[model samples]
Target chain A: MPQHPPPRPGDERTPGRAYSARFHLLDRQIVTEDGTPLAKADDLELIPDSDGSLVVSAVLIGPTALAPRLRGRPARLLNALARRLTTGPTDHHARIAMGHIIRIGAALTATTPPVDATLHPLEDWIRDNVIAPLPGSGHAPG
Target chain B: MRLADLMGARVIDVTGRDIGHVSDVRLTEAAAPSRRLPGLHVAGIVIATRRRSRLLAYDHRPVDAPWPLTALARRATRHALWAPWTAVTAHRRPPRTGEPGTVTLDQTAASLTPLRDMHAHWNSGT
Candidate 1:
């Protein structure tokens, strides 16, 4: 059987030459293993293996992880919002194992199931009582 | 409607209520793999802010004025909608009137519904 290659990071395009990394990945939404929106790539986790070489193990998401990087007032506001929205950021931030990533294109895609999603109480409340209750909750215009 | 045509089209909530004007369209799909597509995807639309600060920032002028949040909430359906076309993820149609105005929620709205104050009963957590 032919061996499949490791996932490729999504495309990176600018007005000029193509380059990729933090700027392209940071703050971008992370897709679920099942193609759902898990969350954004709030930050990158660089874990050093036994050899002392650091490799990206996962994508850290949620406001708590992001607030510190926002700076100044935005950070303060994001921190407060994160505290209100979640049960405080999880100890490790919502982690999406790099293996789950399916491919990279315009945005990152993953085959991993959603760790963070509509399951949240706040999201559920909004979708059910607020979003779903609306006229055409999840339907497209004809 | 053609996205270009809807550029200045008057946008309203599902209930046909006014919120604000359209600012920009957000494309959210990943770029094509084999062939470069200039990174095409219709992810979601970002509506500009209409807060008092934003208004003051505009200084009562239409200087790239941000959109109203109420209008943005309606577009939560763009991704879920999954229509035949993804060229335009969402449209920004600034409401005709200044205030949210009155809109009755019903079948007349097709797939659109008026965005309500979801935070009314709960503490804003602010």
Candidate 2:
């Protein structure tokens, strides 16, 4: 549980500092303050800061970041998936600015707004074809 | 966010890098004849679901449990690495990659040492 008190409007210490929550930290869900689905750190994008010291700027996501790093069957599957879900400019990933990142420990805690992203055509397709027919798709049921 | 989810889902073995569609869930401890609170203890899960979705109906009623495929390759007593509700990490296929996968982890799913079991094609070697 990444339970943290909200920043008091203008706190400066939480953002822009780099910290690793631990190795288990990778692939953790980065949720917004309102608890929305954000992209995963498919890989970390590390670049030296303005001070010339190596720093992790933003966590790279989307197929472009993950697919090249992966190969063979997984690669084919990823490419097909990316092709199926692309609804727009087809960048495939919504990048979260490091500045919007409120915390970097536990589950990635951030405060970015929804991209209004309709990226997962497969997920939406499943919701329509497979999940929707499963009795409770129209309702939250809980 | 529940172990009850592995029933009919496709699972990506992050360690071995092979995608095994979930077939069956094997629990370590069965419903303790008397106590059904915790219900069942998780054991090794069987990936029975091949590419076809019809195969999912072959078993008894599939339980919607969290998919614990991540723990299978880690360096630990397979007995200790079961996921609770909060441990169930739901993932959608990335919009960019369009891969559909979710990870069932307790507090420690992502940190497990990648098991060196695969030869070459089997392990993506990430």
Candidate 3:
């Protein structure tokens, strides 16, 4: 076995409160400041720091972000389907920047609105192309 | 890069010994430059020698409800190691298709701290 320097006291601990990504972050709901549900945090976007340490850059949303985590054959199928549905590039996934996040409790709260065009393209397409053409689709439910 | 890419990557020590696979990533809230909101920094990763589903974090937390289940979870993760981000020397993407990526560490596997031992320090208001 290769000999290595011993870890200093408290070196194993983080400077701030520790959170396990799988337990605390993944699959959590993300909502806007006014409590409007935006999306589930399907995945995380990591960016390398100056020291090459990875940092969570953004919360990734939608099927494109989620498919990879599924792994194997199902993941490939979902990825292919999502690619065909999207008009953007193959890697396109809706993101909410960390700067916009205000809290990360039971649900992530963001200052940014949930109405971005890229946020839910499929839903928007359905609302316009399919729902709008239906009779009485314009009226709110009583 | 995405966290998904690193989730199941193989972890190897300086001697090229297969220690374990990346089980869960640990994050900490840190002061961000030019931003009011704190950024979530990658603190380290938890590596498990055996293939297992989600850890449920019983190994690192004081959760003891349903004693039997908690005991099992704690036993299952006893050998898990916590490799600090600083110890990570390189992250090599697989050169060929169908191979898992590798996370190389500067230290030996024996030198790393046990994941369970970290609970006290992390919960001590640090």
Give the candidate number with the greatest lDDT: 3
In terms of DockQ, the best-performing candidate is 3
Where does candidate 3 chain A have its weakest 10-residue lDDT segment?
Answer: A1-10
Native contacts recovered, each model? 0.00, 0.02, 0.60
lDDT of 1 by residue, A44-113 (tens): 5544333222234565656565665543477668767767766433443555665555455445666665
Alpha carbon lDDT of each predicted model = 0.38, 0.40, 0.76
CAPRI rating of model 3: acceptable
lDDT of 3 by residue, B6-115 (tens): 77788999999989888888888776552233477888988887766456665445445689886787787788888999999988754432345689999999999987
Cα displacement (angstroms), candidate 2, residue B93, comes to: 24
Tell me the TM-score of model 2: 0.37
Tell me each candidate's TM-score: 0.37, 0.37, 0.84
Instruction: Sort by lDDT, best first.
Output: 3, 2, 1
Winning candidate number (TM-score): 3
Alpha-carbon deviation at A78 in model 1, angstroms: 1.0
lDDT of 3 by residue, A26-64 (tens): 898777766777888988998887766787889998888
lDDT string, candidate 2, B1-126, tens digits: 222223334544434343444443332212224323211233233343235432322121222234453233221222122222233344333232233344433333344322122112112211
List where candidate 2 sits over 4 angstroms from the true fold: A1-25, A34-39, A46-55, A62-64, A118-137, A140-142, B1-126
